[model samples]
Structures are given as C-alpha cells and as structure tokens.
Target: MSTKPQFGADIETHHTRFDVDRYEDIYVVGDVHGSLDALKRLISRLELNNDDLVIFVGDLVRKGPDSPGVVDFVRADPCLVSVRGNNEQKILRGDKDPDWLREGDREYFESLPIAISFDTVLVVHGGVDPERSLEDHATDELLTMRSPHGDGYDGPFWYDDYDGPHRVFFGHTVHDRPVEREHAVGLDTGCVYGGELTAYDYRNDEFRTVASKTHQDRASSKVVDPA
Candidate 1:
C-alpha cells in the first residue's frame, strides 16, 4: 500500500517549513509590501538583539515605493526570515524578474519557506484550511486564501472557522487592524496603504505597530472583526 507523500519532500514541490527554537524572542511582522522606511522605524523600536529573531509574514515586495530596498534589507540581516507570499510567488512565476530586484535577491527570495513553525505557532503568508493538515494545503492556499469558500471579502473568514493544534499567524488578508482569533492572528495591517505596519510579539502576546508613510493602494484594505 502507498503511504501519504511528505510535503516538501522534493525541491520542486512547495510547502517548505522552517523550525526556529533558538531565539530568545520571536516577532512576526505583518506584510511589508515594500514599505522600507516604515519597516526601518518599526525595527528601531523593537531594539532587537542577537538572541531575538524577526519573521515576516511575507509580501515583502510590491505595492510600495521600494520593493528592492525591502528585499535588500531583509536579505542582509541574518535575523530576518519570511514565508513566500503571493506577491513573491508572482515574481517567481513571471517570465522575467522585476527590474528593481538586485543581483542575488531573487535567489534569497526563492529560499523563503512556505511556513515557519515555532513549537505550537505556525506562520504562513495567507493561511491554511483549518480542517486540513499542512501537507494537504495547496501552494495557493498557503499563499493567498482568505476565505475557504471563495475569494469574496465577506463574513465567515477562515480564522473564525479554525480550531487549531497550532495557532496560525498570517499576513495576506489586508485589514485596517489586526485580525485576532484564539487559533489565528492576521498581521497584515495594510502598511502599504497608509495603515500601520504591525507585528505580533509571540512571547508576550502583544502587538506593536508603526504608522505607514505612504498610500499605494486602497482597494485591498478591509475592516474585519476579531473572533
């Protein structure tokens, strides 16, 4: 009898997971969306140390003024890591790389995993279907699914439906404020759209934000209630 295939078993298949346990503190940032200056200010406020790590919920590029700058900054710092957001996936799938992407930046972006796991916490760019295992989730689901039913930005979000063994932290569904739930937390506070760039302190169960300096797109913004 055939057994279930392992996710990320091959280099070609997606669903790669990273495990981080050495950090003294772990902070998961919302979608950067190329808001480099805002990200700089937020990092300054954090005053992170060598023992601390900062993880991005993805969408590090596109929508803001400095996609290349954000990519460079994150790549230069060893303390920073990210999951592959839909925007990043777009770059990977496109026939040509973005004109702004510097040499070697594409490879670094490609290296990003689909999910980052810290014991009971799971980080993804979008989110998983609560009822399915990580291995069962498609690449699109891990990178872009907001509602399990369809892409409609209506009631009954996936977070409301989630009853998790691992509390999920995601950033694709742009919100005016953070999406807070018992089993999932959404950190995409629409930083590229003149909203605050937010971060979640996993150890303290707290949130921190830095106000956006630019408004690139208003169409993606949403105001949703926490579960």
Candidate 2:
C-alpha cells in the first residue's frame, strides 16, 4: 500500500511535489514498534550512514518480540534519535510494571527526552498540542494520546483531522494517507499491526516503507497461523 500525502503544500503540486528543502537529511521515521527485522531492512535500504538523521515516533516496545533489540540499536546508533512512544512511556512511568520484562528497556525509555523538534518539522509519539504550552504536557503526553483530544484534542500526543499550520508531524494514529493535519504528517503506518512501516524524507518530502513479514497486531503476535 503506497500513499503520497502532504500537509500545507500547494494543492496543485500536492501530488506533484513541493519545496521540501527545509530539512537537512531525511526527517526519517516517526515510530517503529518491535519490528526489528523491518527496521533493520529499512535502514539498510535507505543506506543510512553517519550523515543521515533518523527520528523514531516512539512505542519501541511492549507488544513486539524484538523490543530489546530495537532499544539497543537506537541507543547505540548515533544517527537514530527517538521521542517517547506510548508503550515506552508507560513502561518508563512504571505503568503496568510487568516483571517479565527487562530492566534495561525500562531504564532506557525512562532516560529519553520528552520530544524532538526542528526548524522544518516536529516529531513525537503523539505530536504537539496547541491547547497547552510545551511544558503543560507530562512525559506520558509524549505517548498514548489518541485523536480528538484525550477525549478530543489534548495536544502533544494526538493525531486527527484537526486543521492549522506549523506542520505538526507525529505518530500514534493508525491512519489513512498519514492523516495530514495543520502542517503535520503521521507516519506510524501501523508497522507492528500487520501494516507497512513508512519513513518520510523530511528533506524533500520523500518516503520509504517496509512491509510487515507476518500478522502481528500486537508485539508478541508474530505468529501467522503457520501460513
């Protein structure tokens, strides 16, 4: 499934192209769950080197099998940067406190920055919220927020049909056409949920996607009935 989406770019050139040179390297990925194989393959395909920058949308663990693997790669890779995903946030905040999980994963997440922003784009697990200031949101706001506020539009951690500008890019909403809102783009693409994982070239508005290998709606649901 391929989708060429845009935010406030010229409607005439919406499908054609836009002046996306505002960024340095590719804006890269928004979020990736435990799809380690897919993530590795994607990075290889992109030819990611020391120069390029990768921004993860969040949710690096909790439902997928390679949660630990993903964390290790992100932490070690200098080019790969990530905001807190909902699952990561929950784990860091001691949400479920599952004893079966690894302590390193929890510590890694707890140590992550709240959000990532740039002159040309903004990145997060949820996205930015206009209702409140940046400091108004707690760490959990960096993840787990759905569309339409907490009940509607909370800010920072959400994606939906909201309209504005500033190109608020984020993930968390498994959506159609990356769900363009204001000046934002959502690339969560539902990678771990049997959907494609997409990475956008924030530099020129380009994108690369990696297909799922099996039916995994949750992190641990990699089994495809032996098909």
List TM-score per model, in order: 0.89, 0.73
Model 1 quality (TM-score): 0.89
Identify the candidate with maximal TM-score: 1
Cα lDDT for residue 183, model 1? 82
Residue-level lDDT tens digits of model 2 in 27-88: 55845777788888888877766667787777766555687788888888877877677777
lDDT of 1 by residue, 69-182 (tens): 898888888888888888888888884467787777767768888777666677889887867766667778878888888776785678888887678899888787898888
TM-score (C-alpha) between model 2 and the true structure: 0.73
Q: lDDT: which candidate is best?
A: 1
Please identify model 1 stretches exceeding 4 Å from their true place.
Answer: 1-21, 95-97, 220-223
Task: For candidate 2, give the lDDT of residue 120.
Answer: 39
- Displacement of residue 38 (Cα, Å) in model 1 is 0.5
Q: For candidate 2, give the lDDT.
A: 0.61
lDDT of each: 0.81, 0.61
